[model samples]
Each structure stands twice: as C-alpha cells, then as structure tokens.
Target: MGFIETFGIVFILEAADAMIKAADVELVGYENVASGYISVLVRGDVSACMAAVEAGVRAVENMGAKVYSSIVIPSPHPDLLKITQIYNIDNLLP
Candidate 1:
C-alpha cells in the first residue's frame, strides 16, 4: 500500500492521478483528516506501489503543493488490513 498526505483537494486529486498513471496500482480510498489535511491510499505490488508513491510526491512538488507525507507498505499484515479496512469499507458495516 501507498499513502500520500496533502493539504488540499486539488493536490490530492492531482497526486492520485499521477500515482496511478505512473504504475499499475489501485486507489483503495482516501481519508479527510480535517483542517485541509487529506490522505490518499493506494494498493498494489511493492515495486509498483513504491513507484506510484514517488510519482505522487513529485507531482505535488511540481505543482508547487506541499506533500506532508508518503509511505509504501510492501506487505501489510492481514490483521492490520482488517483493522484499517483500506481496500474495503463495506465490511466495516455491521
């Protein structure tokens, strides 16, 4: 999985687009942390995920936007996925 943290909706959209275009990756979802802090999540093979994240960071920087954070998790634990529900949120409903 890969994550990109930005400060605005425009940045998030641009970053996400660049990331996906850079590699074969899927956008899991996004989270709005409030106060203009937003996080985008993506999932794929380790290499692709890494490349996507790097591309996203570059996209934001090239656009003169700030990237608060970027992370690539090669192999997240199944239990962690269960807790985060990154790839699927429908399961979270009771």
Candidate 2:
C-alpha cells in the first residue's frame, strides 16, 4: 500500500494519475481531510508501490504543489484494511 498526501483535490488527482501511469497499481481511494488536505491511496507490490509514490510526489512537485507526506507499506496488516476499508471490497462484490 502507498499513500500520498497533498493539498487540493486537483493536486491529489494529478498525483493519482501519475501514480497509476507509473506502475501497475490499483487506486484504493482518497480521503479529504478538510481544509484542502487530501490523501490518495494505492495498492500493489512493494517495488511498484514505491515507484508509484515517487511518481506521485514528482507530479505534485512539478505542479508547484507541496507533498504533505508519502509512504509505501510493503505488507500492511489485514486488520488495517478491515478498519480503513481501503480496498472497498464490498463494492467489488458481485
């Protein structure tokens, strides 16, 4: 799992675009924490998640947007998903 935090929805969308295009990853979702702060999430293999996050940061920087935080979790705990519902598994069910 990877997370990229930045200001504004536009910046977050740009980051998400760069992330998905830079590697084979699935965009879990985003969280708007109010006051223009947003966090984008992605899930994939460790290397891919790293690359995606790097690309996302670069994209935001290139747009003159500050990246509040970024991280790549190689192996996140299953319980974390249950709590956050990052994967939105319920939406994927048939």
Maximum-lDDT candidate: 2
**Clash counts for all predictions:** 0, 0
Model 2: lowest-lDDT 10 consecutive positions: 85-94
Checking candidate 2 for backbone clashes, the offending pairs are none
Give all candidates' CA lDDT scores: 0.86, 0.88
**After superposition on all CA atoms, what RMSD does each candidate show versus the true structure?**
3.7, 3.2
Model 1 alpha-carbon miss at residue 60, Å: 0.4
Error of 2 at 63 (Å): 0.5
lDDT string for model 1 (3-51, tens) is 9999999999999999999999888788888998999988888899999
* lDDT (Cα, 0-100) at 46 in candidate 1: 88
